[model samples]
Structure formats: C-alpha cells, structure tokens
Target: MKAKIKATWVSVFLLIAIEQTIKIIIYNNFFDKRFAILPPILYFEPMFNRHYSWFNSMLKLNAGKGLHIAVVVILSILVIVFYRFLTKRIGSIKIVNIMFAFLFSGAMCSLIDKVFWDGSLDYIMLKGFFTFDLKDLYIDVFIGLMILLLFTKNEQLKQIDEKVLLKDFLDCLLNKKHY
Candidate 1:
C-alpha cells in the first residue's frame, strides 16, 4: 500500500512536470509558428486555447478569464469525486491506481494552465481535425484505460473465483476417491 501510494505520487509529479516543461518550451519557441511535420497530417502550431477542449466555439460565454476559472474549478471537483469513488471501490488494483494518477495529473496540468497562463498551450494539430497538447493526450489515454479497467474488472474477478471453486471441487473429489 505504501509503495503504491509513493509510486502514484511520483507518477503524478513526473507527468505534471513533463507536461509543463513541454508547454513552456513550445510557448517560448513555437508560438505563432507552424511547423508541418507530415504536410497535411501532423503539425505544430502553438496557440492559446482559452476554453475547455473544443468549446471555444460555443459562445463568448464568461469572457476568457472567467471560462478558464470555471473549467479549472469543475475539473478539480470532478477529479476529487472520481478519486473518492475509485478508492471506495477497488483502490488496491494497480492499474486503477495508475489510471487515477494519470487522470489527476492531467487535470492538475490543465488547472495549472488556467491559473497561470489563463489558457492552455495547444500545439499539436492534425490538419483539418483539432489541436491539443500533451496534457490533453494524457487525459485522453488515461480515461480510455480507466474505462477499460472498469469494464473488465468484474470479468477478471469472476474468473478468479471460478478457478478457485474448480480447484476446491477437484480437491474434494480426489479426497473422496482416495477414501
């Protein structure tokens, strides 16, 4: 338990550090510059995203600053609720713990941007698709993994229980045959 807790904290810190470092470097060097790596596929075009995900097109809403603050607050609350729920259910599961760490780290990374930069530094673009940052990728990947874990957890546990029951039944049969 202690080891898992330590590992979780370390992972969260490392993820946040890496996300911030990449964002800072891109902000300093690639701002307003578009570097096409794969012509029409992949490119680096740093821009400040002042809204949550692709919601910038929704409306002016509460100005950029207010929107950023609201995003941060909402994400923070959701992270807290998720952590509590996961802890209550299967906190000892290694994959679940790692998933939560990534999720929390991603949320914290976005929150940091909202609090400090008033927006997130988005650089990677898929031409006609969308633009996102490392933090966004982290969040996306972890969310998918968490969903997978949740879906398969019951199956895995049921398999384990079945195996144990089978073993016990075989043992009883062998003992009766010996007798």
Candidate 2:
C-alpha cells in the first residue's frame, strides 16, 4: 500500500513536471508562431487559452478565471472521492494507480496553468479543430487507458453493484462513512 501510494505520487509529479516544462519551453520559443507539422492536418502554434475549456470556447462562454479555478478544484475533489469507490469495487490494482496518477497530474497541471501561466499553454493545434497542451494529453491517455481497462475487465467490473457503490460514495461524501 505504501509502495503504491509513493509510486503514484512520484509518477504524478514527474508527469506534472514534464507537462509544465514543455509548456514553458513552447511558451518562450514558439508562442504564436505557427508551423505546419502536417499540412492541413496538424500545426504547432503556442498561445494562452483564456477560456476555461474547449467547450467554453466553442460556446463563447468566456467564463472568468475564478470560475475556472473553482471548477478545477471541484473536479480534483471528485477524483479523490471517486478513488475510494474505485479501490473498493475493483481492488487496488497497478493499472488503477497509473490511471489515477495520470488524472491527478493532469488536473494539477491545469491548476498550475491557470494560476501561473494565466491559462493553458496550448501549442498543438489540429487544423480546424482545437489547440491543446501536454496536460490534455495526460487526461486523454488516462481516458484511453480507462476505456481499454473497461473492455478487458468487463467481467470483473460487471460483478460490482453500481447502486450500492453510489450509495456508499454518497455516504462517504456526507461523512457518514470512511471512504
């Protein structure tokens, strides 16, 4: 258990460092300079994103930084809370540790970007789609791995009762049980 926790923290910090370092390097050298990596498909153009998320930008919400930070905090809290349910239902497996580390690192990086970089330091742009940074990659990797895990662990996951799990999670959240 101790080893797992230590490994997870180390991985999270390493990922966070790598993501922030790349963002800083691109911010200093490639900010606003567009170069076609793959013509009409991909490009590198570093810039600060003022919008909280792509959804916000797509909808032109222009949500304030305070709201963005608050949302991130809430999301982070949810992740931590969800972990108890995850460990209880699936057991503390290595892949679970890896997924949570990626998620934690990504969320922490987003918070750092908001507080320090003024927003996400987006550099990789897909033609007409959107621009994103390494933090996004971390989250994407976590999501991909989770999907793969679900597919591979379908039988194991199906054995768990979701309603009871939800009730337990809520009980933990309401301080009725130790998560």
Candidate 3:
C-alpha cells in the first residue's frame, strides 16, 4: 500500500516535470509564431490564450503567475478530495484510479502552461478547429478516459455485490427455518 502511494506521487511528479520542462523550452526559444521540427501537426507554436487569463488579457500584469497560483490551489483541492474518496475503501471501483490519473496529469499539464508560458501554448493545430499541445493532449485523453470509466466502473461490481447479498440473505432465511 505504501509503495503504491509512493508510486502514484512519483508518477504525478514525473508528468509535472516533463510538462514544465517543455513549457520552459518553448518560452525561452519560441515565444511567438514560430515553428520548429517541421510538420505543422507536431511542433511548438507560441501563442497566448487571453480567455484563460484572469486579467482578461494574456501577457498582462503577472497574469500568468496568478493563473499558476489558481491552478495549483485548485489542483490541491482536487487531490485532497480524491484522497478522501479513495480512503473510503468502497467497492472495486476502478474509477478512483482513473480519476487520480486525470487529476494529476491535467493539473500538471495546465500548471506548466501557467507557470512558464505567460499563457498557454497553442500548438498542434488541427483543421482550424482546436489548437493544443502534447501536454494538452495528455490531459484531454486522460480526462476523457476518466469520464468513460465513470459510466462503466460499477456495472460489474454492482452485479457481484448484489449476488453476494442475495445469497447471504437466502442462507439466513433457510437457517432460521431449520432452527
């Protein structure tokens, strides 16, 4: 159990480290509309998301710092709530693991943007619909997986638990009749 806890935190930290490293590299080298590594599908493009800034404008008044702080605070709250829920030791709901994975990966990914980009990096352009980065993709996929896990996690477990309870109740009734 202790090892599992340590591994979980290590995984979270590793993701955070990788994300922040990429953000720092992009900020220092490519802070504008520049692309390297060829292939528009996969390269760093420096752009700001004003919609994500608390100051109503990206690259304004330490807004990045404020956003980073806000993200960190929110992530901390999520970790706490998740920990509480996991501690309940409820039925075999794999959703708890999925939630932790999404929570940590998403938080780390966004935290990197907030800390290093003065705003988010708008990389990975796709057919003029959504712009994102590798980190963003990681966060998005994990979150999507977490949502799907929510719908399916309990179905099999619910059946097993119900069967166990029914069998136990029947056994008790039969025992009482014999007595």
lDDT of each: 0.73, 0.85, 0.58
Q: Considering every candidate listed, which one attains the maximal lDDT?
A: 2
Error of 3 at 111 (Å): 3.6
What are the TM-scores, per candidate, against the unseen true structure? 0.73, 0.90, 0.60
Q: On residues 27-87, what C-alpha lDDT tens digit does candidate 2 reach at each position?
A: 7776758898888888898878878687788999888889988999999989977975677
Q: Which pairs of residues collide in candidate 2?
A: none
The CA lDDT at 67 in model 3 is 58
**Which residue pairs in candidate 1 collide?**
none
lDDT of 3 by residue, 23-130 (tens): 667667766655644465555555666444434443356444675558677866757554543433333244555456556676666665566554576655554355
Q: Write the per-residue lDDT of candidate 1 for residues 135-155, one digit (tens) a residue.
A: 888888898996786577455
How does residue 170 of candidate 2 score in lDDT?
A: 85
Off by over 4 Å in 2: 88-90, 154-156
When 1 and 3 are scored with TM-score, the better candidate is 1
Ranking by TM-score: 2, 1, 3
Per-candidate RMSD, Å? 11.4, 1.9, 10.3
